[model samples]
Target chain A: MTEIPTTRRLDGHSALITGAGVGMGRSHALALAEAGAAIVVQDIVAETAEETAGLVRERGAKAHVMVCDISDVAAVNAGVEAARADLGPIDILVNNAGISGGMAKFDDIDEAYFDRVVAIHLKGTFFAAKAVLPDMRAKGWGRIVNVSSIDGMVGCPSSAHYCAAKAGVLGLAKAWAKEFAPWGITVNAVAPGYIDTPMMDGLLDDAGKAAHVAARIPLGRMGVAADLTAAIAFLVSEEAGFITGQTISPNGGEVIVGF
Target chain B: MTENSTNQPANSRFDGQVALITGSGKGMGRSHAETLAARGARIVVQDVDRAAAEETADSLRAAGGDPILAIADVSDVGAFAEAIRAVEAAAGRIDILVNNAGIAGGSPAMEEIDEANYDRMFDVHVKGAFFATKAVLPGMKARGGGKIVNIASVAAMGAVGSRAHYCAAKGAVLAMTKSWALEFAPWKINVNCVSPGWVMTPMVHAVTTAEWRKTHIDAEIPLGRYAEPWEVSALVAFLCSAEADFITGQTVSPNGGQVIVGI
Candidate 1:
């Protein structure tokens, strides 16, 4: 059989991903790069961020690395500006950097602790979006893919703060989608269920805990990072232009709420 | 603008393929059929009226393409099923289906909209689309993949005037889309719903005069004009393409500025 030539749908696009040092962010960075996007990779952890950048470069797309704590407004702004200057204006922005520390009772959680959760998950997203909004507005074409959690849609027992922040991100995306529709900027959110990321591995170190969580999922297994990366690539591509203001749940059939 | 093969590309994109769009006798349905045919999809022009359906098919044929006429009353299950059978037998395979056949029923209020009107809307928009998919599912599964785009409306997402029954029908369509998408994903059948905004369709034409449409429907749309059917069709074609394999169990809206507030 002759080989069927297929064109890459996302050719020549440029994408910037935050928290690309590890977990889902790193996977999405590499995936987008593979699909022909020049990548700007950022991670709170310097080494991991550089590693992700190297991976993108190896995949034949230009890659730049920036190390910044996205939770800090000043740092997030500086990092975005640096990346823009180095790689060109970003057409896609993946707000994938987030933290989910183990379960804690709502009453037991202090204000400071809750504030930190909002800082990284919610505040970081706003600041990064603020940094890139003008450029996105100028281009008249942009795709902002915010990474939310299944917790945002459905509550988890001991994750009040985590759930609230992710849920806030969903609200943020919807409001911005309406505001930016005229400018051709699309905003969307992706909520993933228990995926096999480094974050999950840390909590489910023992076989028993991992098995317990996997059993609860309808698919009988947790999702892999690649599962979500596949979806992220589609949403950020040109094909998904009409798909804005929607939240796609690639949770292996976990959250079953229909329109 | 681009040419694709019929087998769906190796990456599994809807490369060279064909689709049949019903209710495409005009409006949004016609838009989807034409757009897909432009992208290398053989067109199966389907409609209730034989002449209208043939007219749409002829246009596609005249444009350096071949299309088959698929005529039937979608409200009738047997008629819908037979239409799918004919399309499959003639086209050899149904790479895509756009369930865009629909009507708008009006009443003073929910209480006034009697059972007959309610059932009529369900028969064509919901039940008709249901059996059509059921008939094609096996063929699509056997062929190793397919795409089905259910034409839902924003009315399903929110409330509209005297449309309780219509809303109920589209709501069922939206729910059915999720269940079907999950069931069919493994077989590579990507089932999705495209909920269009207020569009310039015959249904709109019947309910409102040009003057009324300008003030009532057009003003409410964030984009300030009823969507041309082609805009809605373009999105549906993208979903049917291989580019959207990972995007099952989703509802894509092309409403100018109407946002689904929550959930």
Candidate 2:
């Protein structure tokens, strides 16, 4: 068999990853750096963003830190502008920042909590993508990977707001994929199942809930941050240019939603 | 858009492994075989035509692959079972199965569809994949785990012209992929589907003119071009690799933004 040689896939690309302070966002930031892309690590917390930037620098890749709450459109625009100014035009954007919005019964759900989740999860994704398009358009090359959840694809009890927001993110990805394809940008979403992250700890509530979720996964284990990153890495790669407007579910067979 | 080959390392993701790809004589199936075999897999090229299967095997051999040939109509349960046995006997075990054998039947309107054509479509796509998994399940379970990628179409997810039978069959494959994934999770078998949009292949070329494709199909696809078979194969290879261990029961589409447009 003819073996192709390995080379850095993102040697000249600069990526902006939101929620890069911890969990999947951090992992994505590190992985993109390792793949040779300079990173802009953005998080609501200044310390966490700096922490992630430190890790990115350790990998021999340049890192710039931006602190902002993505729910605020002005903050998102400013953060993205600062990232591009510091790191050059963003070639890749990973909208990984999100909140779980703690579970609430559908009928008793607080209007304020629902709006908060939507603003951050759905609206935030839209803002991030919108912010990066100009540079991507000028260069005619870009990749956008939105971090959604299995809850978005399947109904999860007591997480209607989270589900709706995540689902909306998918819609945004598809819409933007078409709108941006003419400019050589590809937009996709990743729906991760129960990954072993701080977020999962907050979502499951107990060991029994975690175990129950794990049992349902065909892979027989909770996914790790690396699992999610692997899919993200593939989506953001140059080889994946033909793949756009799709949602890849790395859920370990927990839920299968096609199309 | 410029088409530059990505310089990805040839990791032995499928080394010391045996893969069975149905209808691998040409098109996307051939692409899948080449991708997997290039990554160090011994391929079992299955096709309904012996000559076609041998042709694919010959190409694999020329590319430094130790390929075996299995000629059988997958729609026939007995033939498919016999073909699986032949593969096991020749290669020891099956570590991967790509159900890429499918026919694009005439796109008759729903009411105009004949029972014969509809049944043939379902028999070949849905039932063939179902029984192929059943045949390989025992060996894969005994060997610990395996990967199964069913080659579905974007039609499964949404409407596609008048090909109701084709869409229905592909849709069934998608649903069955999930069911098998859930049932075989304990056994460690990963089942997924790869749904492609408009791909530039002999089948497609025979049906549509280049000008027609450019004006009607390519214009609609967000990527502004039809997908090469290798692009589809690349995604399937990833799904079959170790890196994709946590991804199962998912329909990963490499459709150049077609699905997003919504039928």
**Strongest candidate by TM-score:** 2
Instruction: Give residue B222's lDDT in candidate 1 (0 to 100).
Output: 40
lDDT of 2 by residue, A92-178 (tens): 999999988577789877888888889899888888888988999999999999998888877688879999888888888888888
Could you tell me which residue pairs clash in candidate 2? Answer: none
Between which residue pairs do clashes occur in model 1? Answer: B4-B15, B4-B16, B5-B15, B5-B16, B6-B16, B13-B242, B14-B242, B18-B42
lDDT string, candidate 2, B169-214, tens digits: 8988888888888888888889888889888887888998878988
Query: For each candidate, what's the DockQ?
Result: 0.21, 0.47
DockQ of candidate 1 is 0.21
What is the Å distance of residue B44 in model 2 from its true position?
Answer: 1.1
Q: What is the TM-score (0 to 1) of candidate 1? A: 0.81
TM-score of each: 0.81, 0.91
How many Å off is the CA of A24 in candidate 1? 3.0
